[model samples]
Target: MNLNKAWGILKENGFKETTKRNQILEIFEGDERYLTARDILDVMQKDYPSMSYDTVYRNLATFVSLDILEATELSGEKHFRMHCESDHHHHHFICMDCGKIKEIPLCPMDLLGAALPAYEIDNHKFEIYGKCPECK
Candidate 1:
């Protein structure tokens, strides 16, 4: 019936060619930022008359499940952005003004001296935030 899976993917940009999915992808492409659910729905409404909040949430959930999107919290709200990973250990520098991600090839742990005593360190996250070159 060409209902949900109507769009044929042209490449490996973590998106199918469907109208709705493509629209969502275009939003991310236009601005690589951490988008909240409302942000996505607001942008999609301009192009899709029948699009709903639930639909947007569902699609976002799918993307997160597939690891194509990363959901994180900022201030007190949750946002989503494209997921990029390398085969090695590294970090990212995010532009606070514009959510552009830049890879940092160094690990902070390497410069440290063990786990600061017995603190039960399970995992850690590292990200630097500032304006990007374009934004600057």
Candidate 2:
């Protein structure tokens, strides 16, 4: 999502604009890779030396709750990226080395659903992790 849309969502949800929040959003703007809290902290510390992990994590939680960002576990730690702007449903292939994401248009559920015909499935998330070509 774009910064303006993110701001609009915040406004619609009765959130006031703040410099820190804007900066957080800017970090994800135009970047299509997932970022860890440490990654954010590294960038933020340059501008606000006193920034704490708690503060960055709190905002990350807020963004995820608001659906402005998407979260995933990478190498046992949580990473986040801006919500996908695609109009179609899809999953992703994440690069382990670079954090780059490639959209996967095929849904594995199509095959899995057939195998679990007796059970009801509510939802699912499928992601493939590997090195991207450049990283290789």
Top TM-score model: 2
lDDT score, candidate 2, position 14: 93
Window of ten residues with lowest summed lDDT in model 2: 109-118
User: What is the RMSD, in Å, between candidate 2 and the native fold over all Cα?
Assistant: 1.6
After the best TM-score superposition of candidate 1, give how far the Cα of residue 85 lies from its true spot, in angstroms: 5.6
Per-residue C-alpha lDDT of model 2 across residues 1-55, encoded as one tens digit per residue: 9999999999999988899889999999967899999999999999999989998
List the global CA lDDT of all models: 0.72, 0.91
Off by over 4 Å in 2: 117-120
Q: In candidate 1, how many Å is residue 66 off?
A: 1.0
Q: Residue 41: error of model 1 in Å?
A: 1.0
User: Candidate 2: global Cα-lDDT?
Assistant: 0.91
TM-score of 2: 0.91
Clash number for candidate 2:
0
